[model samples]
Target: MLGARGGWQALRGCASLPRAQPAVRLRVREALGAREPAGEVKVQGWVRSVRSQKEVLFLHINDGSSLENLQVVADPSLENRDLTFGSAVEVQGKLVKSPHKMQNMELKAETIRVVGPCDTWSFPLKMKERHPLEYVRQFPHLRCRNNMLGSLLRIRSEATAAIHSFFQDNGYVHIHTPIITSNDCEGAGELFQIEVSWVEKLPETHFFNVPAFLTVSGQLHLEVMAGAFTHVFTFGPTFRAENSQSRRHLAEFYMVEAELSFTESLQDVMQVMEDLFKTATNTVLSKCPRDVELFHKYIAPAQKDRLEQVLKNKFVTISYNEAVEILKQASQTFTFKPEWGCDLQTEHEKYLVKHCGEVPVFVINYPYDLKPFYMRDNEDGPQHTVAAVDLLVPGIGELCGGSLREERLPFLKSRLQRLGLADAYEWYLDLRKFGSVPHGGFGMGFERYLQYILGVDNIKDVIPFPRFPHSCIL
Candidate 1:
């Protein structure tokens, strides 16, 4: 029987057979990392590559958990067909440095243990065949095994954790907001309506007395919490049925929202956004170095250096009027010319940000007609009531959307009445009626932010399970 150390010794001594070696142990990753021949290593992982050389079988194995894979040279006399591609196995081998970089390390196996067998017909992942995103999305279970999807998912996880940590360290209370809400916070009228079926003797309503729609944002709810907590935030999945197939929009996506009470000005909101973006990007860069490297190398080659540029450069802030002016000046490419009152289209947003280089730029003070009714009116400005700021990135525009809310009950009520939303927001007005403060918050599109940070094109690539305008793939 091979001891664990002896098993590793067998793998290391594979290039030249170790004399009279007992049992050995090796993991697929450790065999891949085997640079020294003095010590023994044991590794276990899925089969990544296989080649038959007469009597010996040279196999490359990877454990989906990491980017590294181990090289195993097994004698065909052991009848190791059970360790085929996608199969899990344990190998005891001696670690030896490889002459070539492709197979940087080598393992000579004494005993190979089969852990589990992958279905030949069902296992779609293989070294020879790499599937596209559309086909991979069809197989959700195996999608993570692919290099691009795996790195993107890993970055998503890291970014999520970083977002939470950034909020926690910055004296913000993490609020878990409700998913079902009666209010349409954005007031865009693109809601996915919720209804229930009742076949037996019906009530007059089709919704089974539950007049609820999926929450488009947690901003209002976080405001309630911010009243008590001073600084509060919510990270949750929000639903939007806008039917927009844009590269930045998703029907169901995560949002990072933070509402701060007693902010001095819009500058405070910009500060929070800049700090949060930096923290998220730096955290992912540090924690998921390998993933970041892969993204920098393959998916987004330009973004690797751009990440640092965004971090080091000071973020620029401009008014909606100024952005419109710049857009109009650069209107050669835009189909819809930028007007004073018109909303900044995604194309215009991207063009302006590209002008600002890789740094994030805040487009503030949008026109009253272009924004929601909740934003505070600029007292010193002309007719622009929207006290909003949208954080624009280089490749992806509008990563974060936020505003200083109208805190005064009278102004809010008057705006609601003018917009014909008083009836819809009766409860929202109540917050202002009871006890209101100078509260402001912003909503960051989680996938949009991820796409910007990761340099990905389609928003679908950033989300693990994406729900688009017409897609609800399992």
Candidate 2:
């Protein structure tokens, strides 16, 4: 049942796949590392541990198949005996009872099959202990050599797949937003500019002819497509030039952005965000129990518990003013002092989540100057700006950010004018004038969520081939 996908009907007459050959096989973990198995069995894996004593050799082998590895005992008398660490080999032997306590069962190898022998000079990773920081730098190649790292990457992949599947099943159209753009969506002055020499040869007159920058967020472009399609989302790389070398910051990161059209209010956008977050957390927990266990033991138990709590509890919603008031009264330890008009720093965000038991908190009604022009104007308070929501979680500062878009052309135009961004967003202004309906959406940093779920400390570790301030390793 575990091997086949479509049950008995799909494999009715398929002779190629035998009933004995399951879709996936599980190795006997008890037969690991100098442990003799109870009977005869076939063992296979990469060499993990090897200890030789004159005539006999003991081997601890791993297949990267599971957390547990297999042990093979090799004799020096073998005709073609050649093997080392990182070598690929297969062992045929009798599964006998184990005398060694390290592994439950041991394999009495009758024959050895060496697929490939790893050259001693070429293998850089030794069995000796390696420092964490140095290992991360030298770890690009040998990371998969360890079981825990492999498990974390496996879980990360599953979570990514779940993200796409969750949106696709909900009838969300996948939109491909441009990475290079003319307008800055966040207005935070963090965009990475893309410059070329096209205008360099044209003298001083054509110096400003070509202008483009890597997009910090795909919200504005996705809004253009959201008006046509009821639900549209973009999953791609977003860049920021800010040189903050914190655990939560990254120069280049993946953003899962969605814009829902014809929305009732900001509440609708928040609800969608809640749904997406819950789905991703639940899917990862359900699918990766082993990886979750490893992450809990080695990384941070608080991160895993925080995600679980978020899935169960009703997310707390508070306005920016309310948050400011709470920060003023709270006794939590925060490095940055929170003020009414000032932006909530990482320390403040972390403190708020911890106060709420580290569950997801929706901070809404931000100051107009803090948020962008696309948000719907909130006319209730003193500041009549667009409605915006930022979902803050434990470990990660702002996991998700969304706002109800301003559908009115005049208000959007005025907001653009006041922000001194009219020239850059003339095309975006066209969306409001041309049959724009009530639309709202949010963008979640995919790597940020992965970092939280996996309990990984740095954002660079979660993303493959990360592009940070000082490093861009292929």
Most TM-score-accurate candidate: 1
lDDT of 1 by residue, 1-474 (tens): 899999998888798764664545544544555556735556777777678878887877766555656677778765465767778777776777776767777777766787997776667776767566667777766787777787777688879999999999999998899998887889887788776655574555645365688999999899888778899999999999877888778899999999999885888998999999898889988988887787677678888887887788889988887888788788367877878888888788889888777578999988777878888878756664578899988878788898898888888899889988898788888888776788788989888887777777788877888888777877
**Residue 391 of model 1, lDDT score:** 91
Give residue 273's lDDT in candidate 1 (0 to 100): 92
Q: What is the C-alpha RMSD, rounded to one decimal, of candidate 1?
A: 6.9
lDDT (0 to 1) per candidate: 0.80, 0.78
Which number leads on lDDT? 1
The digit string of per-residue lDDT tens for model 2 on 53-153 reads: 78887877777655656666768664254667778778777766666675566677877778888875667666534435236545576666666666767
* TM-score against native, each model: 0.85, 0.80
User: How far is 36's C-alpha from truth in model 2 (Å)?
Assistant: 19
